[model samples]
Target: MSRIGKMPIAIPAGVEVKVVGPKVSVKGPLGKMDWPLEEGLGAVVENGQLLVNRLSEDRNVRALHGLARAELSNIVLGVSKGYERSLEITGVGYKVALQGRTMSFNVGYINPVLFQIPAGIEVKVDKQTLINVKGFDKRLVGQVAANLRAIKPPDVYKQKGVRFMGEVLRKKEGKTGK
Candidate 1:
């Protein structure tokens, strides 16, 4: 038995969990999320908690047991409390702005990069250099953040560009002239 899978997830207030066949839907104050159950794994809502069970002792099933539980827990938490990722621009003249559902980037480029914010996700800019990505789905929030960072990844020489908040970059030494 997996330790994480054996644990019960406590359903918080204002959060509703519904399990229908191979699909589980979690609805909360923030939003709603649904996940498809994997093979050989089962989920049940008992009392005020959610439980995950595996139908076999197979190694693959055991591995999926914990993964399914964690994914469900993330869905529950995401819908209830939400998720957010912050990024920092570290170059001169680099800036970001959020207008409506579009995020405009001016990172030392001739033409500003425009990223259309996807549905169910919110993007906010602060101090012209800080970006905050918020959403009810953990995976979407992270992927969006990664996509934004990929626009101008940090430079190895100056460590300049977009990076996750508190992320440390090791600067590379430039070549010396003889």
Candidate 2:
């Protein structure tokens, strides 16, 4: 048995978790989200607490036990408290702008890199250098931030470009001229 999977998830007030066949749905003050359970895995809500159980002991099923519990836990937490990721821009001429649902990044590129915001996610830009990504889906929020960071990862030489808040990168020394 997986230690994490055996743990019960405490459902907060105004939050409801339901298991319908292979799908697990959560509704809370923030929003509602659903995900399908893996094969040979089952979930049940007991006395306001949700529990995940394995229906089979197959190799793959055993591997998914802990993962399923964690994902469900995140879903419950996200809908209730939500998740956020912050990004910082560092460079001489690197900045980001949001117009409507589109985000444009000017990271030393000839043309600004454009990104379209997906549904159920919110992004806020502060002073053109700080970006805060928020959503009820942890995975989606994280993926969006990673995508933005991928646009212009920090340079080891100049330590410029887009990166996560508090993310550290070692700077490299430049070659000296004779």
Each candidate's TM vs. the true structure?
0.96, 0.96
Off by over 4 Å in 2: none
Question: lDDT tens digits, residues 103-132, model 1?
Answer: 999998899999999999988898999999
* Top-TM-score candidate index: 2
lDDT of each: 0.93, 0.95
Off by over 4 Å in 1: none
Question: Alpha-carbon error at 24 in model 2, in Å?
Answer: 1.1
For model 2, residues 1-178, the per-residue Cα lDDT tens digits are 9999999999999998888999999999989999899989999999989999999999999999999999999999999999999999999978899999999999998998999999999999999999999999999999999999999999999999899999999999999999
* Candidate maximizing lDDT: 2
